[model samples]
Target: MPRAEFDKPVKVLIVASPYYKDISDNQIAGAVAELDAVGAGHDIVHVPGALEIPTAIGIAERLSNFDGYVALGCVIRGETTHYDTVCNDSSRALQLLGLQGLCIGNGILTVENYAQAAVRADPKDQNKGGGAAAAALHLIALTRKWGNSGQSVGFASDILLAGGKTTA
Candidate 1:
């Protein structure tokens, strides 16, 4: 996997849901290792479940100065429809936040069973947690590439004024 290189160390926040303690621990381990390898500093914050991961990151984004966020959790299918609700809603929330220009990586696992969750969360296996961290780093790199130009899309102020149009 291609990774972004940085001359200065970046800071990241890992928001994890510890509903499944062992699984969450493993995922956290993988994410931490990846951040360490890239010399990025990180801090971990635990929430109750998958749905809370994005909320925590949103709070941190407003209150802290993290360069990016890694969201980690596991949602296993159960006998009820609650599973679907949790999976879809959590994913959607993360996607929405990303669209709003927040650098967030969704690592929450939505699987049919515990076995499937284990394999994906394991650092020695798919290492999805680490992959999430990498995703956030890549986004941070892109944000840095653009810097803060404060330019907006659409017609320039002068053009809008000429047409007797105003932007409110």
Candidate 2:
């Protein structure tokens, strides 16, 4: 994995869903550990479910100064088709936000069962939460690499009149 180096401490916002408290807790632990390893500061916000994670992050992006964002949640299959909707929609929203140039790491787990979710959420196991944090860090590094290069170009016009030269 590529590690991002920072001269100053980076601040990240973690938007998590506690629908499955145990899984969410584990994910948060892993994410926190990873951020601490890289000397980055992080703040966490809890929403009701996976679907709300993106909206919370979007609000933060518009109102706060976080360097990056980590989204953590879990959606296990149920009797109905709600699982698919939650998983797909949440993931899609995060992707769209990323495309808009917000550095975000999606750690939302979509699994067939609780067992599957457990393994992925476990810090001692797959540790996907940590991976998400790393992803955000890498993106932050990339953004910094292209620092301040998003400026819009201005058009300048020079006009020569009969009496004298005029510039607009």
Candidate 3:
């Protein structure tokens, strides 16, 4: 995978839910390794479950100086529809945050059983946690690229060219 390069120092916040201790640990290890490889600074925070990962990240974005976030957790399917709810809602919340321009990497795993989660969470295997961290870093790099500019871009510039025409 192509890793994002940075000009300035980057800092990331890792929000991990250790509901499944074994899986969560491996995921965190992968995430940390990826961040370290790029010399990105990071801090880790734990939540009780996957559902809370987004909320914790939101809080950090609002109050902390983090450049990005990595969300890590595992949700194994069972007899109840609760698995669907947790997986969908947590993912949706992260997406919403991302839409709002928050640099976030969602590493949450929604799988059929322990075996599936194990494979994906393994640092030496799928390394999805590392993938998620990379996603966040790329977003942070993009943010730095665009946010440093002094002028507006895309549609706004087009509107100005059109003599202040309003889309609405």
Q: Between candidates 1 and 3, name the one with more favorable lDDT.
A: 3
Q: Deviation in angstroms for 101 in model 2?
A: 0.4
Cα RMSD to the true fold for all candidates: 3.7, 3.4, 4.2
Q: Ranking under lDDT, best-scoring first?
A: 3, 2, 1
lDDT of 3 by residue, 4-68 (tens): 89878999999999999999999999999999989999999999999999999999988989999
What lDDT would each prediction earn against the true structure? Answer: 0.92, 0.93, 0.94
What would the per-residue lDDT of candidate 2 be over residues 1-168, giving only the tens digit for each residue? 757888777999999999999999999999999999899999999999999999999999999999999999999999999989999999999999999999999999999999999999999999989988989988998888778567545644566777897867
Q: Which of 2 and 3 is ahead in lDDT?
A: 3
Candidate 1 lDDT over 1-168, as tens digits, reads: 677888777999999999999899999999999889889999999999999988998899899999999999999999999999999999999999999999988899999999999999999999999999999999998898777457766764654456688664
lDDT of 2 at 124: 98
TM-score, cand. 2 vs. native: 0.88
lDDT of 1 at 77: 95
The superposed Cα distance between candidate 2 and the true structure at residue 32, in angstroms, equals 0.4
Error of 1 at 133 (Å): 0.4
How close is every model to the real structure, measured as TM-score?
Answer: 0.88, 0.88, 0.89
- Candidate 1 has a TM-score of 0.88
Clashing pairs in 1: none
